[model samples]
Target: MTARIDLTLDCANASLLAAFWKTALGYADEPPPPPFATREEWLASFGPPEDGSEDDGAWLCDPDGAGPRLSVLRVPEPKTAKNRLHIDIRVPGHGTPAERWHRIRAEAERLVVAGGTVLAESDGHHIVMADPEDNEFRIAANPAA
Candidate 1:
């Protein structure tokens, strides 16, 4: 059997990032593990942190169960450099180059309204964008037709 993987993102505000990602990726808030009706209840089992800080994090899962789970955790330090790895949101469609680019730009605009900032564009290829926390990601037009 193949192993499943989950992606974790460190941020200053987990809830805010989670909300943006949920909109970007069409993911839903992950349900608490079995035997716990609510996330608060499950977290309570772990007790408070050693430093007495609140456990600030959010978990998200693809509604279709096809994508890796995402975990956004709150951290003390701010992001100072570019991310070596980033997510690519693909816009796949069967159309001419112009049509494909339109689709890509449309998605990028939607993301902009969802708290993303467009950094660069490659015309008919892809667009680089940054999330609310400045994590870089891409919106690409799929070459497959």
Candidate 2:
């Protein structure tokens, strides 16, 4: 038997991280559970915290329903260490080394615009990047893909 899986991210702001991920991955925000007409209706049952942040948790899904579900969980503490596990964004590029680097850099730039920062890069290989919450991930070239 096989088990299904979802990606979970612990961060300070679930909503903000979810938004950034959705834009970066071309995902869509998950709707409220069944019987709730809207997200607001679901939230009203418990009410927002004193700070007035509406989101306590958030979920993002691939628009085509092909990728794993992303669950953003809000936590009080900030990320103090590098991620033990990180995501690698692969961009298909079957060309020269320069072309591959270009593709990777382009993707990294797009992610930067979506709240990610370029940390470092390996020539003709991968670009290490960090999300808004400083979660480390990589953008790499998949030439054989």
Candidate 3:
């Protein structure tokens, strides 16, 4: 059987990161499971955390159900270093090299408006960016596509 995977990120603010990621990946807030009217209600079903601390997190999923779900969980510590693993937001299309780079820059600009910061740009390649919580990710156009 094929294994399914979900990506989880540790951040200081779950809601903010989730919002940024939603905009970045064209994902949406995952609704509570069936029979539950609200996320709070669904969470309540699991009872309180064993340690008595509140469970704080945001869940997101690809609207088309092709990508892995993302979970942003609140953590006490801050992000202190570069991410060993990061997400690559692929801009979809085919065009001349200049046109492709333009598309990448356009998407990067949109993400900046959505609370992402562009760290660096590789000409006609990719743009390195950071989400609101400083999680590093890249925006690029697939050369093969």
Assess each prediction's global lDDT (C-alpha) against the native: 0.91, 0.85, 0.90
lDDT of 1 by residue, 33-92 (tens): 999999888888899676633348999999999999999989889999999999999888
Candidate closer to the true structure by TM-score (higher is better), 1 or 2: 1
Q: Model 2: per-residue lDDT, tens digit, 1-145? A: 9777899999988878988898778889877878998877787778667765557678788888788888888888878888999988889858888888899999998998889999998977999999899999998987567
Predict model 1's lDDT versus the native.
0.91
Judging by lDDT, tell me the better candidate of 2 and 3. Answer: 3
Q: Candidate 3: global Cα-lDDT?
A: 0.90
For each candidate, give its TM-score against the true structure: 0.92, 0.84, 0.90
Q: Best candidate per TM-score, number?
A: 1
Worst lDDT window (10 residues) for model 2? 47-56
Clashing residue pairs, candidate 3? none
* Cα misplacement distance, residue 92 of candidate 1 (Å): 2.5
Candidate 1 matches the true fold with a TM-score of: 0.92
Least accurate stretch of 10 residues (summed lDDT) in model 1?
A: 48-57
